[model samples]
Target chain A: HVTEAVHEYSIAHSTPLPEVVEQHRARSIDFANRVGMDPGMMVNTLQAQFMLFLAKLIGAKKVLEVGTFTGYSALAWAEAIKGQEGAKLVCCDIPGPHTEFAKATLLEAGFLNKLVTFFEGDGVETLQSLPVDQFDIIFLDANKDGYLPALKTILSRNLLSARGIVVADNALKQGLVADATDKNPHAANSNPGGVMGYEHIDEFNKFVRDNEQLEQVLLPAFDGLNIIRLKQ
Target chain B: HVTEAVHEYSIAHSTPLPEVVEQHRARSIDFANRVGMDPGMMVNTLQAQFMLFLAKLIGAKKVLEVGTFTGYSALAWAEAIKGQEGAKLVCCDIPGPHTEFAKATLLEAGFLNKLVTFFEGDGVETLQSLPVDQFDIIFLDANKDGYLPALKTILSRNLLSARGIVVADNALKQGLVADATDKNPHAANSNPGGVMGYEHIDEFNKFVRDNEQLEQVLLPAFDGLNIIRLKQ
Candidate 1:
């Protein structure tokens, strides 16, 4: 009965913390509205806070964020690494309205020195310019389509610390990833956007499974966050 | 088009590395068959590997496991903490056929002292016997109904390290969780067992939300694993 209860508890209340995050979406939403930018459907604040806490727990000093929409995620990370000696956050983003807002807010947060590097322009190019094995923690919130490329680039350049952990946003498209390949008779409508199309998260899940360089778990919080830790 | 390919690739690949243990699974399966067991569960293998890797990466020395089914999970933690002096594992279980097998294997693996201690009989009672602040990692794979109670006992007793990690398995229940709660009509039959009474996971998830002392992530891997790390 008790074992059954535990299983029941899990099924009944799966997204425990995310519900609170859903309630606390005001700050991010307001910030997005004022800056005339969308939050790019990324991680929620509570989720961001938890991640930053994880980064600090692991003693992360040098961090990399591929996208900088209003700098919320960047600020969360900066808060953790702020007072540490030689701590820094390297943010990559093309010049945009949100990037401008992010720059101002992060500066006001007094994290400018600790979270100041900006790789303006193409993320792939910017990632290439960085020295090898530099970042202790990397956040992949860039173009969803670029998730694999950016990851390959990071791996090839040896940008991640041997113990580095990377978190990718929106790895699952709602429940769209439930079906492995969706090749049934209704497969066409099942996958409206085709194999590599937009309205799907299967491709991403498969990529994570196929890659033999890292270990990852997909969390169903704030759309779907993939928590990946580099094995090497 | 290139972006689409990138997107598809992102889902198609990830950072998981080749596991050295996969090659041995068939052998393990044969051993299990000869010894009369299910070779454990495939999902549990993935969960065990992931948890062991994390524990090692975090420099965990003291660990606790609630279940000792065939000693597979215990072996995982042992492997991670093998070389470290003073590293230990505390396992709680009722005497079973797998118990003898576990003892022989662990002792043969040269973990006689390191792999010391197994509390037979009531697991909850055995857990209470551990000295406070003694564990850096705790794995919950015992009786399902005991999850919440075990969580309370471990946290209350302070057996967990200050910066410790707790991973609870089988929280997803083959997607049956939603049915018990009636959150989604589509997922109505998910929870055939009503033991999920009072929406336990929701209560747990919400507890994590308001509690700033811990950072948690619920991952959908091998039925579902909830990772809770103490915040500091």
Candidate 2:
């Protein structure tokens, strides 16, 4: 429950994102506009700042990102682990212009080979090939339907470290997951390609809640963020 | 902004709080009603769950709480560091019925003296007496006016560990700290007992934001929560 004024106030009070990451975010937005893609695909600046805070709070060294759109978020994560020895970020995304843009942007930011590696292929396949129990943080920001499968693979295969956390973006889909009815204005655009988008996210939310192995908190901020950790 | 349905949906999907903690929370509400105290002094269930997640995420071992209204939030921290070796939670509050209730409740929960210690004095004095660079997490929920002083003492005295964080509850004061005008309904109640509540909170927010030694993110959930860390 945030008003526009309060949201702006919060952002103004928060630590500003690094200038290089901000530059990448701007370029990503421009690229999305030029290519007629949804700019909302990228996390907002505040969300990025929150993720950075989380990464450093847990001292995350190895991070796995399911979607690396133009490397905006990868840049944020890179900033989080900038000076840590042996820190590495592995990003997986589909092969397309988005990957190309991400590679170039990250390279220009001087973190390409130094801190980040890209696996340009299917998300699930890339996750399957990674070493188990290595990633201290796994960020899920890909397709809605893939959220569940990716989480399942991560847990079943032990892809997350002993103290790792999995953060899933767009878990609520503009509150559609909670109420996808006519009463909600956003519900009108809740579905595309004849598939109910909220259903997939709702299923993911329910699965996370019911799974005895996981404990989660669904933050009702910035579309929705699910912070999950393996029960000790 | 969040609607009632979405807020409910979020709570339902989040990991449930422990049954003992829930019982404590219920008793806290009852105590507040019986004594004509505001139940809002205690944190809601969702906020407590978030704190638990944060504590575990950072593997907090030593916690310092500036407020312990009936020991509700302290119990949450205790659960977070349950089985860890040498874990301790120090709670400071003015001696009164609140302290007695907190002692009884925490003792009933098997945390009094075993895991939590009560200082029973002024918040600032209590903070000043804490060991330097020891506390992994410091919870600030005491008097609104004392927030800045308490934070200053914690910083100047190095009460927070190198990787530790300071969490301030009610940082926004029901959005009044951002907009304390007639346009906001909460503004009228913003001033009580010849003191302006929002101004104190706003001052604390600005001080935290302007301090070069600290980085913070203000989450617009549950009144408002400020997550802060020392600049490395």
Candidate 3:
């Protein structure tokens, strides 16, 4: 029944930063491990750092994260939005056993006051029912099959800002997208919701190409991330 | 002497649209048969289509083109903006023997009205002195050496709208950028322009990476095109 977080790697590896930023990232990972939550979905350190760097460069203040497993991915985005004027994150996820651990970690990291709203409900319904027109940036790391539907809902709601950037994680699926039409053995066979929507990365590529409003490029970072933007 | 622009290879056998677009692209290639100036620089028809499609999708109205060799690029952009509610293009290029021919072609194509404006002058100077700051999109295909300077000028002028996208052509340079530090064979002759100011494509890649306010991806289509947007 231990809930304490740990940092296995030394801070010596990272460049100078506010000690608090580095501490939170490590602590966030520890919380996930403590709860038996899989940290496997988190972006690799280099790619995470780069994404944070990009968010900082863009001065992102409002962020939307579609998945919150153990709070590792959420922390990466939250940290990037830090130091900006009035930054906040809206994290969406269905209620799970790990929610308490994630909430505790966010509080411990002093991010509660930063408006990290945690809504416990059906993620798709939550996203569709949300009342908003634009968000500064959005990150997707939830159910793989929900990407397109989530995107459609977000765009329809105008929940993405005019200059907003959208990042979709697990796009490469361990090189599954190299040939989009083929099936991936790694995809979970059990459909928890009675629906399977595993995406072939190539199909997503086609999705981007066919979607005139989005200009997308797939970066083979970590598991692969699709960086997209409003076409303007 | 009839100065007719002809592709010795029969047009029936070629992808004429791309050839037409490339004719708009600027290069010092001496055509074996040049009837009337260079019939605009051959624009990469596909690339032009890409940019134009993006422009329309974003509802871009004001566009500025840094180079108008033969006006093929200008025409492609114009074609995209033509049917829109109110879109216009301001093209900058020094007047030369080819300007007259380009003008005729644009007019014949029915793109000469208010949609296209030709500015005969040093493109860099024009870009620097332009009075406006809210361009929906900007295309850079001017002097190769001027690439960096033109980019700086564009960034300094703040001509790009928040949702604006800037596409720079000739980014790959036959893969010379694969080793950007090495001197390019094309620039070895000590041409004053120095291969459009960058010895290799790597320099441009570095430029894009170093800038904090923009996100750029190099696409391998028609030589190479760099698609960029403000970081946010």
Candidate 4:
């Protein structure tokens, strides 16, 4: 009953998103509509702000993003690292309308490949082929099914910098991951375009929970964000 | 319709709270019943975890707390600083049942009076009497109206370590702060309880938003938490 009001309360109280980010978000939303994709995939403004603050709070210099949808989140990360002359963000996403839109929006955000280097391939393959430089922050937002594999790959390959943080967006899929009964339409493949083909997101959620090398907490806000701190 | 589901999803996905913290939380709820007060003032486990990660992320060696309701949050901070033998947490709260409950819980957590030093009296006066020291983190969970004044005190006093963070619980005030309209029941005076006396929390939210020395984000989840990073 009071749920929506409570959610809106926090959003209204937050410092509004920067003009640059909001503009990029608008462009992404427009592009998503044109391409008939879910605009919800775009990083919400508060999430963008949180990620930006976190990156700066830790002095993150190198950022790796698995999903570059419209580049909203990457742009946010770039904003945080702007003062550093050499800070870089390596983004990986498949060649598609989403990334194409991301290219256009990144340009609009005044970063247009400046601090960002967009890879043109699947996240797993792109990450595997890259030179081994440690990443201070590694964000996972692509293909929900790949969360576990992507995380395992990130850790097993020593891609995270010392004291690095790994953030996974949409760790909870509309509460379906928590309670995937017949009542939860999101758990069904036919509902809402098989978002990530309705993979067992719960499994990925569990791996992060049980991993010995990681200490994690899921910020149960905004589609369920999983914030994991690498103990190593 | 999906709002509650989303919130629950995140909470469910989170790593469950340990027995020590849970025991404290349970005790607080029970104590709140005895005191005829709202139990929601206790920091939720997810928020607790986030605070712990943040403190450790900045390698916090000193923490300051403005409210010590049963000492739940202080314990959370202590858990984060477990290995840092010299780390200290200074807490200020009035002498009352809450502080008494906190003392008992702290002892029950196997950390009675360890790493934590409680100051009894008014928050403002208590803070004023303390020696000026840069804290890696300063948390506010006191009177609602105290948000701005407390923040001003913390900032003017330079009470934050370099890369320090200031966190205020209930920055959202049940969504009423965002829109103090008569139609919004939570915005009305006859609501659950005025944790901070509903002292225009939106204004406090706005001050944090507008302040230059502070870069802040109001997380709309979990009753609206505002996290501010001191730029200096």
Which runs of model 3 end up more than 4 angstroms from their true locations? A1-40, A43-62, A69-88, A94-110, A120-122, A128-138, A149-232, B1-60, B69-76, B79-86, B93-105, B120-122, B128-134, B155-193, B196-232
Worst 10 residues of 3 chain B by lDDT: B1-10
Winner on TM-score (2 vs 4): 2
Which residue pairs of candidate 4 clash?
A220-B10, B70-B102, B144-B196
Candidate ordering by lDDT (highest first): 2, 4, 1, 3
True contacts kept of each: 0.18, 0.70, 0.00, 0.56
Best candidate (score: TM-score): 2
Tens-place lDDT digits, model 2, residues B1-232: 3377888898899998888888888888999888887887888888888888889888899999998978889899998887789899999999888889999988988888888888999999888875554799999998888889999998889889889999999888888877767777886666732323778888899999999999989987888889999988
Kindly indicate the candidate among 1 and 2 with the higher DockQ. 2
> Candidate 2's residue-wise lDDT over A129-163, tens digit each?
87664789999988778888899899889888889
DockQ (0 to 1) for model 2: 0.60
Per-prediction TM-score: 0.71, 0.95, 0.58, 0.89
Query: How accurate is chain B of model 2, given as a TM-score from 0 to 1?
Result: 0.95
B45, model 2: CA deviation in Å? 0.8
Docking class of 3: incorrect
In angstroms, give how far residue A146 of model 1 lies from its true place. 4.7
Q: Candidate 4: global Cα-lDDT?
A: 0.76
lDDT tens readout by residue for model 4, B10-95: 55555555567767778788889989877887787777767777777778888989988778888888777766867888888889
lDDT of 4 by residue, A158-186 (tens): 89987888888887766766556667776
- Which candidate model has the greater DockQ, 2 or 4? 2
Candidate 3 lDDT tens digits, B8-52:
111211112334445544432343126445433455444455565
The most accurate candidate by DockQ is 2
The regions of model 1 sitting more than 4 angstroms off are A1-40, A44-50, A130-133, A144-158, A168-232, B1-43, B104-116, B131-133, B171-213, B220-222
Answer with 1 or 4, whichever has the higher lDDT: 4
Q: Score the docking of each candidate (DockQ).
A: 0.23, 0.60, 0.04, 0.48
